[model samples]
Target: MPSGPEVLQAIDWRQPWLAGWREWGEPVAQAVADGLPLHEALNHRSAAPVRFVPQAALPPGEAYERYIFNSGLCPTREGLHDFFNGLCWMRFPRIKTRLNQLQAAEIAAAGVAPLRGPVRDALTVFDENAAFLLAPPPLWEALMGKDWQALFVALRPLWPQARLVLFGHALLEKLVYPRKPITAHVYLAPPAIDTIANLDAWLAADLGADKLAGKPFVPLPVLGVPGWWPENENFSFYDDSLVFRPRR
Candidate 1:
């Protein structure tokens, strides 16, 4: 695996999806560049609810989420995946903690069976691939209805008013090699959530066991968000039906 500094060197850090993370990520990158391991760099910078620890610190047979819930220490490894995970914990501690709490509760109720049940599955999906979109009703309506033309073209002007903050660490890591088909499981942010801090706290309080199990998300191809990718400036870009599939 590449060292933390090498992984930091590979990220552009300017991607809009990474905007929320840049402030925290830059300092962590600098520490890694100066020879700290990824987990150590993250721990040093962490004022989060949970601490960052080496992956080996997790005892065998213990579930990752359970370990964090029980110990308040997130098992972290050195790579873009874990780097983003650690950054997410720092950036959105409340949301991350809520996810771990929900996951651990499910594990306690269900045990570590092969099938992770609906609630755990939904929580895992949100943790790995969710994005929070604070957009106008038109965009939200078109997106939920899977109306590509209306969303990307007819309502293109409205995108400037929208704020799509990437909350999933795995989603952040995937954007490193961005492609057309790369999508996010989008959750519409409540109105007036103009800042990341407000969004984090609101979302953490917003999540619940019953609500998450419903799988409330709309699929949005990340690059299709206006200004996110240059190629999307052309109207024909949404013509790729595979990436922007019509609602069934």
Candidate 2:
């Protein structure tokens, strides 16, 4: 797997708006243009203070929009660069529901038992700003299949400036070989495996604030088996290698 600094250095490193989508399909590209504005796309830092409506005010399908909009304003066009086709529930309902349940269960199981320091560090980054982004698992898996050229074509337009995180058993299978023999049976639905949180209680143990926010702390994929266990003998991140760097 790529080291944290190695990953960070690879990104184009621009504010959100200045990013480009090198290969979006016409319809998806048009949808983005129609839904957001240029200012909203870049320069709008989500951590800045913003008000939000209670869940009661949103229509059933739109509850997730709270994460995308800032104080009820649609994200700027540049900000939309952070949006992924998989993040929207209207586009992937089944996966969304499964992901929520899996996450809730993990937190419940880990309740207050001090998480190992590294995992805590990961969680702190996730919770501090409630940052959100999405990925396409199938596309990611395909890339691991040694189709880097095609994956680059598809993701360039969407993540023009940054190195996208790739985690999950398939990702690992494609990118990093395991230490021992493992089964091909491990896998999770895309939604359940796509998130990275720097702020979950246990995942935030010892990291300083500077390391938990912004550039250095890019998303890291955490692989889980389809039903929520490790597909192989190694299930804990503590047992896996970890790399962290100061946020830029």
Candidate 3:
């Protein structure tokens, strides 16, 4: 595995999937390049509500979310996973805080168990693998229905009007080594949210325990998003049934 600095150096901040993160990521990357630790680099660049601390800051046996909730510190480790996680906190602080709040609440109510119960499970899933998509109803209908051909091919022109922003840090981390099978748990954003800031605020306000527990997300193959991967431009790309499964 590459060191954190190496991972930082390898990222192409200009990638469409990384939009809205360059402003924060570039400076943090430079700080790491200058020999700062990943957590310290994140601290140096962050104005978010939570402080970035070394992973050791998390006491052994304490729940991660519980610690963050109690201390307002995010324990971060070196690597693409935590690197993207820090970026998510920087870019979508409100949403991250809200998720942390919910997770901490669940931990408090039920204690950390082998099975996190439904609400905590959903929160973890969202934090690790969610994406926000703003598109026309037709695009959404096709996507939610798992009609990949119609979504990616028939409505291909409509992609110009759509915006898909990756929210899950794990999803972003996996894309560093792009694979056809990498997918996102997509949440639809209100069409009015035209900017990242607006989306952050809206999503933070929109998330609730009941809503999250329902797991209202549609699966989207990240590479299939128009313009995200060049190979996807070919109609044959969607024919990979393993990646683009039909609705049951």
Q: What is the lDDT of residue 9 in candidate 3?
A: 85
TM-score per model over all chains: 0.97, 0.23, 0.97
Looking at candidate 2, the ten consecutive residues that score lowest on lDDT are 16-25
Candidate 1, residue 209: lDDT: 94
lDDT of 2 by residue, 64-110 (tens): 33333323322322222223222222222333333333333344455
Query: Total clashing residue pairs per candidate?
Result: 0, 31, 0
Model 2 regions lying over 4 Å from their true place: 1-28, 35-81, 85-88, 111-248
Q: List the residue pairs that clash in candidate 1.
A: none
Better of 2 and 3 by lDDT: 3
Off by over 4 Å in 3: 1-3
True-vs-predicted CA distance for residue 111, candidate 3, Å: 0.3
| Ordered list by TM-score, greatest first | 3, 1, 2
